[model samples]
Target chain A: MAAPAILITAFVVIGGMATALAQSLGLFPLVGPPSLTVAAYAAQASDLPVGIGLSLAIAAASTVVACLVGFTAALVIVQGRWCGKLVAALGTLTVPVPHIVGAASVSLLLADSGLLARLFNAGGSWPELVGGPWWIGVVAEYGWKESAFVALVVTGTLATRAVSYDETAALLGAGRLSRLRHVLLPLSLPTLTVSATIIFVYSLGSYEVAWLLGRAYPEPLPVMALRLFNAATLTARPEAAAVAIVTTLLSFGAVAAALAYLRRSTLWR
Target chain B: MIPAVRVEGLSKSFPGTGAPVLDDVNLTVEARSCTALLGPSGAGKSTLLRAISGLERPDAGRVLVGGQDMAGVGPEHRGMAMVQQRPLLFPHLNVLDNVAFAGTVRGVAKRAARADAAGFLELVQLAGFGPRPVAALSGGQAQRVAIARALAARPAVLLLDEPFSALDPELRSVMHDLLAQLRRSVNPTVLMVTHDRSEAAAVAEKIALFSGGRMLQHDSVERMYSRPVSLEASRLMGGANEIPGTVRNGCHHSALGALRLPGDTTWPPGPGILLVRQESIEVGPGNGPGLHATVSGLRVLGPRRLVSVDAAGVLLRAEIPWGRALAAGDTVTLSIPTSALAVVDDPDTAHTFPGAEKRPQITVQGLATLASIDN
Candidate 1:
């Protein structure tokens, strides 16, 4: 029943990757004769290390922040209180907003001379959050948006069966903290792992959020690739393809590592 | 000694529901004794058990455990353990670790708790089954592990919410035997909620009957079956026949004919219901000197046959041993001793009694033999 969707996804991803790989090898260049060479990859040697490290750091930070916040949100929501209902509503509302819109909203809220700076009356003293050295604004956008996704998925799995087990544990003399440590954490681990992997891969490959909120010196892979692809010099196209291919390989590597870890986890079953 | 658990004037009502889920309930379970909360679905039996365990807070009531008021105590501090119908074993833990959960939560070392848990596993007859993941256990084994885990806590009170109802019949019987063994060894004060009358009668010393959130009667298991307080209570306890009639002097005049009531029956002369258990009625050939009855229907129920007889215009059911051969339409005589007769106030013309009705214990040979046969 799902064969068609899976086939279409596979075809698009594989075909696009093949085209990028061919271009990175200096074949089918936009303004030059078709020729095979490693010149584009060699040209990117200077900037590739910085871009890769920045991208990995951003993705890792975002995934960690999202998982922690999302797990807490899910625990609160499953508690079935009025505040839990409010958190659930907030998560539901946040999931549908595009990452770009979230990035814009975050920049408006955290930037120097932005809403927060005016509200706190710290115009001159406000930290450089937006386009900052730490990439705070960029990571915040992805973390805030992706945490909602993680919360909803994890809440779905916990709401069904966790309550009974929790009650049973409590009846067996488990206190609140003990129950959270033994019951909730172990129960939510598998879902948290899966959502974390998804967030990491997504933040690693997405461009617009980082481009709008990041500095220009040590740009993330997606932002660097987009800038190189749009540069006026035609030779930069293959280098852009090379960066894009590297990003794809990193995402694939993250997914493969997650799957391997899940396969070995006793609770994942 | 003070009762192990005491509930007084307990009541609860959920919002948007017309009737209360539990209404002014009171009960007492003695230390080291087992009591079965017997009722139908939605009878608030489980609600009462949860309220006692501190899992549920009653709108207006006081739960006292071992003479200490448990008003603000949480479920963890109540020293109670509950085994639900589904087991709810921690899937992430192995069988040994699951059983050791209570001790570990109390800050005991893992190796020491597991060592103590090994003994509990042996009590439930699953000694070597430890070290296996909970997923590897069958339904019966899982439930046994749940019971073992609860027992490992050494709780002051154990609450069971239809723990065996989810298992197959044969497995349920095996679990009943395991409970009997546990009772002999641990002697934990127990309150179990179940809709299965037989299960209640088999495991509990006292039976508390509930209906529509009200406790009808609380008495010994023998009395609950042989002398129920009301027609509803009798029916709930698996009473097969209710002969509606009037009581005058000491005799109940009904369609089955006038029968002398037991000497200690407190029922005043008024409308009454004569409750006769099916097994209490003895059937023989027509030559016997008893009420004449024609066997109208015969049903094969396992090793026993349910014999439906028409005695004059009144019908009665009698369970006979399958070894005796008697088909439908056979002329038979049913002899019921006057001592076996019990009369309760008829709801139409009198107020039904809600308190425990204690009658003199009368052991009929057939009732004893039937119980033994079942065992």
Candidate 2:
């Protein structure tokens, strides 16, 4: 049981250190012969400012939105009698619909001349709901997809905490909102933090939605990285590897921060 | 004002669960009175407390706090606070804030809430400890803080769910005394739920015994110990020496010789339980036929010796004073002080002392059947 976890952690540490060192020394077989260079590192760092900015913005926005959805879904499922069916429905749908399937389904549902256009157009020309005639398509895809992910993780966690803490708070004369704010929020922090960060990091690296929805000028980090990785002829491969390394680094950093947060937070205690 | 709480015909059954956890359960907690709800684990004392505090909605019953029906009123509105088995202090808040939570929720200003919370800190003897984090308080100190918090709300009814059972004996007594002081000072119509019979007897103005799912008896603590309504209640209240026999004519006879029974209006006597507490029986100098008993085992429990003996092939256990010395296998005369005979009517529920059917002779038995040992 412990072996796989130990092995996986060893792989992550060894893999991450090697990748970092290689990227530093410019030992890319695809790009060129083994060579140490400060220029490649400098360019990578300068590119990272913008990439990391977009990356952090998406992470923060998605995580906050997801935490709210999760908290709300949990409250409804725990306190409301009818929310069990919703949970059942969400649970059943979550497993079969892979990420690619979800991205495709969402796009199919929301794209112009798609189901949404049919609903709104009524024999009129397709409104600029997709293809970014305005900033509508990017916002629509990001909101819809991340919100679903948030609700999915939060529903289970919130339900358990709501049930556990609600009765106890009730006995102690804590009202619904007060209990949620004090007891539920603190007690469910470890799970909620982990869940939101999971959604946030996944959203940052998620390629399917960004590729299908975002345009070239303001391409999402992952999709832009994919574009950069493929078009590399020979010398640009190291730069591409550098972008991959940055994305991977972002995921690790977010997870590390969340773990640190969980340690300092009282819920686990 | 109809007492702080009056629960009548309070019955409830969950969807799939057939029997009601609380079945026609009735109890009244007078203002300024501390009543301990006593029962075995599934006895529904805690459930009853929840219903009174308006946590669990009772199916076919009414809970009125201070003459106001608490049908739709929330727990906060009812002025009822419960201290659970665990301290359940908020880690985010320092000691003052956690205790002040109830007052703040009741619309008190933050400064006033902290001031009021500080008042209880002194009351629970935690005055110097307010500014510290809640995590720093010890279990016993935290429990007192929880009590102080409950009292800070100035609740009309305070429900305690085995609040001190988690503490050691010394701390439990300290907490108990503190509770007694709180009840006297504030008169908040306290209701405590506990399975400890001794605790119930010690702390409650009245003790209600629950068994299986039904409340067997709810009476004053003295009455509950001295004259429990049923066999199970008596057994729960610690009636250790119960024996099976019959009543013939006017004399009550048993596996032991017949003695006089008392007049009891509760049960119409006919083959009933001869209940006696271990401390009630006095062991004296003998071999002169006080049921012809022989000691089997003896344990010296400071100031009290728990002497296990056998009489007439039936096993009886008694707790005698330190001065009353007897060894294993020693024959001694065990006298059932006439004041201690509590006759319960159902023999199947307990041991039937012979001749308890007609007249009123209470023949005390020795060690009961080993079968009743596990019970």
Q: Which is the leading candidate under DockQ? A: 1
Instruction: List candidate 1 segments past 4 Å from native.
Output: A33-36, B1-3, B349-375
Instruction: Give the poorly placed runs of model 2, Cα more than 4 Å off.
Output: A1-57, A79-82, A122-129, A133-161, A232-235, A242-264, B1-3, B15-18, B243-272, B287-302, B308-317, B328-331, B351-375
Per-residue lDDT tens digits for candidate 1, residues B105-224, read: 999999999999999999999999889999999999999999999999888898999999999999999999999999888888999999999999889999999999999999999999
B1-375, model 2: which lDDT tens digit per residue?
Answer: 225688888887778877788899877777778888898887788888888877789998798777777898886567678888987776667899888887676668899999989999999999879898878889999999888888887777778999999999999998888888877778777789999987887788898788756888888998887887777787777676665554444444566656566554333435655677788877767655466677888878798888876766666678877875578878887888656776676657443522324222223323342223323
Residue-level lDDT for A39 in candidate 1: 87
lDDT at B194, model 2: 97
Model 1 chain A — which ten-residue stretch has the worst lDDT?
A260-269
Backbone clashes under 3 angstroms, per model: 0, 18
Question: Across all candidates, what is each one's fraction of true contacts kept?
Answer: 0.81, 0.42
The residue-by-residue lDDT of candidate 1 on A1-269, one tens digit each, is 99999999989988899999999997778985889998888898899999999999999999999998999999999999999999999999999999889989999999996899999999689998999899999989988999999999999989998889899999989999999999988988888889999999999999999999999888899998999999999789999999999999999999999999888767886
